[model samples]
Target chain A: MSAMTHEEVRELLAAHVMELLLPEERASVVAHLAGCAECAREVESLRATSAELALAAPDRSFDARRCNGVRSRLLARTAADRDARARLAAGQLPEREPLSLRPPHATAPESAGGWRTASMVLAASVAGLILFGGSILVQSRRELAQARESESQRQRLIAGLIGPGVRLIELAPTERRPGSARMFWNQTLGAWTFLAYDLAIPAEGRTYQIWLITPDDRRISAGIFTPSADGNAIATTTYALAADSLTAVAVTEEPAGGVDAPSGDIVLLGAAR
Target chain B: MIADVRSPDDADALVTRVAGGDEHALGVLYDRWSPLVFSVCVHILGDDDEAEEAVEETFWQAWRQAERYDVTRGAVATWLTTIARSRALDRLRASRRRQEETMSHLSETKRAAVDATTRRGDDPARSAEVAERRVLVRQALLALPLEQREVLELAYFRGLSQTEIAEHTGQPLGTVKTRVRLAMEKLRDRLGILRERDA
Candidate 1:
């Protein structure tokens, strides 16, 4: 489209701020404002005035209970979003997905074999004499199961770190806090492996929350963790987002369970390449 | 919980804290501004439930984007009302689209009448400061010429484009655009003085 003349663009500023312009016209106005400081300033002034028009709406009181309900629900939603992100970061898949870390081939056959072995043992043992052995077997099986799960988590973390499309984001210490952190985002696998070092432990009832900053500057909670006594921490989780969605990563000190949104001092921040 | 209303500086400080991830500051900002935001939503959406949802979305966006707010450009109230209006308008347009699809046979006049039926009752229990601000804005709007005021209201409250406003009011599109500009300029001049006095 041909560019609007300066006088024509000035006439559109009022409608521009009110969002009454057509898409093409709005685009023209935006294009003009980028090069014309005077028009931009006028638009800002008009926008402020237009916002006041909202105050002219009839004054009405909401039921206090209902108003409070909205507040409670909103805050709760934020906290829930944080928790969900924390869960994702922790590698706890959502309920709809399978949660077992064990390979598909290892699960059913292993359980079936265990049952078969238990039946054989039951047949071979004198009932009262087998009690002690049964307890020992159970204890051994539990330990083995835990070891298997730990190894699986380790393998997954390693896989995420070395996966294709993995990018490293280094977070430098914010002025208010001293800490350095790095995040390995595996775009292809939707996994995040975050490691932080040289950080002071938070105060009682406080933890550090990690955030993923999107291109539009929205901060999405990644997860929350407390560092070890020596100020080192690692967290791993899988969240499938578009490859180019994240623009940066940050860490902030938040209350122990984490709030819905970031509301603490930024401890570390790094822009994504 | 309802707290005593604070000065604009305090409001700005709350926004600053909110930018730093301060939940308490967000809560305080909500307590202070939800009424005005709700009032705008209710006026546009005309349903308590939807207006309440809009209010929630407005503050949620505020909490998420507080860092983007530039205090040199506008007050917190203006920043919030802008968000509130945008969200409410989104819902309004969505619902209108749905209504148009399902109620396509309804006459335009009947639909307009239905739109006008959303009752706007005054609440006498509002805070004095909020009540005063409302009166000032209303007075500024009332001072505009009727034709100019009509176009502004059509655009602001109805979310109409200039072409749409012209179609709705049966005036030339240029005339509608000129009226919108004149009306907004007058409001800026009138409310600009009030803002300076408050500052």
Candidate 2:
């Protein structure tokens, strides 16, 4: 085989380190390194160094407060979503509940209980406790499991979202505005997730509106948002992109009765490319 | 009776559960390693708030893609750390001016797990040799150029694929390959003699 140039060898160095060499390339590099003491030595040191860093990398958890905060926020939002869905189904007002509160369990009224015999009461209490405790345990385990699965999903998506030249724009906080929006827009994907961090939800008659700016700088109505319990405005459906036409995603105040145009001013912007 | 559980098996089980569209499992998985993963980010980024957000965002992503885990490759810590590192690095790369500077800071702040292993000097000569070699490895790593050290870490430590590495680095595919090769060659040359001498 002809002698490899320094550049050729250098190029091969990376592939070899990764063990990415095709069968022929792997063989050639292996063979060359065996006889080429200088090259062979370099590969060893590099591998050693990589191993060191990886091993040395501190594998500690982030701030407990931050993690707990996320869980609390998610839990609050999920509960609100459940309640809203329930209220929507019941045709009743969307009753908001705090973390310290829970929905009243369905059970017979107290009059039905007082007339019952002592045995019946004992049996009923036992059964009720069993049912309640079992349900809570199952639900909590289920919820915890859901959190784990969500974490995994987040990891993969974040991996995909991350690439060369990808830009992340964090929207400034919307001060005291209940119908506000926050954003994480990726110009590469031309996609954004409009989140309601802490918005005082609009009345049942009113809703939040999201607008997207076209590449030519014209504003396009994208979608509408409603804050879940905990006032989190989560986008139900992801917005589609139009090449680089996306400039920014803005949320405006609209009438309790919805409108075709400017219900309010721009609440948040991602400044999409 | 089953002994104490492990993170790896839980990770595997969590992946299976997630594949079935169970969100609770995702949370459990996040709780187990979010700290370790976040620490990796903070270590790489050297900022608490940024690291915290990165971890939160990472779990949000994990919820959607847990089914992709393949257990035969490596440990869960390795896989998650790889992801965390990638995210942290992406943030670092986005702030171009901070890249070169953050690295030196990393080097300064960095500490090797030199004596972490339980082996002792009184052990067999081979064990001693292995321990010594490991220490040398750590030393050799701190000596590499920032680029090579990083690519090397992501590949061997985190087990990222070449294409993924290329995508993460944002360099042209060919250029990435070339840079890895050059880096390996340099590292190989440095360690070749030590390895041979030890052998």
Candidate 3:
């Protein structure tokens, strides 16, 4: 080993490729390769194998973090499939069509407010992910749905008409809480259609209620409602909403049967406005 | 005791480690074979997005499907390279891309990012060569008459259903069928002749 030239040693280093040689093999490989030229040739061949094992990895900055997000969402969506379908059918929160992914470069940040509004709609739309469980090869199908384009939303000034005497209300965001509903007097629909958007999903087994105002100004009952997937509540007569008794639409915590109205502390207050 | 994983023993140990969720061991496997995989994906599917997407899906799929990976059939690297290649082919088909057309514009951006990263790492040119070599392999693959190469590329790299490949290539369907069985026979013959010459 001591007699070997540096170049010969370097060649054998190929056979024994590494950052540093181990203590046991270090003395032996170094000893023979010092004098033997053919043994040295073998080392060069060995070196190629090590060189072939380069250590580059994919960039981990963005996609690695995104992978964790994908996994959690995949698990949650798969588990909650049943509840999602039930709610969609109950309230008829219109099912959105699949949207194709636009090239990221096609669109750029222009205005802040427009994006903020659009993103809110986008966030709700993406909640329904396509199933990609283990039936097929382990590939996933977690797609995002797009909110209907704004032009379509704006052009469609859709109106709902209740019975001759119906209660209609608008839910606005309040300083303390996000949800607040106010009744509107639309003589066309008689009964009120509660338009609540700022409200988040109510607690399990509980719902928001609408109340009618009697001529004496005493609060009467309208109907109870469960929130849609997007957390907006609509007044449905399937349960208890009757023809017009003009008052206000106040959402109160109610049991399954519901109260005569205005009994619970009002979560939303939509008076004729 | 080994510097390179070239033996049966080494392959077995690595598989054991992989099955145990050893990501570093997975890294070791990746370091050893990513070039083969990346090359194959780029070759079969011209688009970089589909290739990278295929590779990512392939690695994750391999991780989840580790229990099923068998060692008797072929080398682990070959198995993995095959997986990535298959996914890339599937993506290419899904996108309905022609043999030369790229499906994702984002892939070009990714290549730029890789080039920049490599330059910062020192031998940026060598890093670029690694990418170039894959393109060359693709060019070589494309040079083969559309008949045999399509079968070989699809059967070997893309992992298409034979029927599916038959449908896409629009060959006699039976002509597509024989091409794969014959192409593999030719690949083996070429490898055998090379081995004999080396001997």
- lDDT leaderboard ranking: 1, 2, 3
lDDT of 1 by residue, A20-64 (tens): 888999999999999998888788778777887876777668767
- Per-residue lDDT of candidate 2, residues B1-199 (tens digit): 0011113455678767756656566666666666556656765666776676566556544544556755543345445655666677667556645544444543343221222221123211122333344344455555666666666655543344567567666767676666566556565555563354345
TM-score of chain B of 1: 0.79
DockQ of each: 0.36, 0.15, 0.02
Model 1 misses residue B20 by how many Å?
2.2
- A159-201 per-residue lDDT for model 3 (tens digits): 1221223344554443477765544332332223344555777
Best-matching candidate per lDDT: 1
**In angstroms, how far off is A32's CA in candidate 3?**
55
Could you give the candidate ranking by DockQ, starting with the highest? 1, 2, 3
Model 2, residue A106: C-alpha shift (Å): 41
lDDT of 2 by residue, A1-273 (tens): 555665576567656655555666677777778778877755654433333333345334444545654543333333333443465577543333222111112222223112211100111111111112112111232343334433222222232233232344445434544343445443333334444556666676776666665555555554565555555543422233444645666676676543555557666656654
Q: What's the i-RMS of each model?
A: 4.6, 10.2, 14.5
TM-score of chain B of each: 0.79, 0.52, 0.59
State the lDDT of candidate 3 residue by residue for B58-142, as single tens digits: 6656655677776543346545755665577578667755445333533442343233223222222123433343233333333
Against the true structure, what is every candidate's RMSD?
20.4, 20.3, 20.5
Best by DockQ: 1
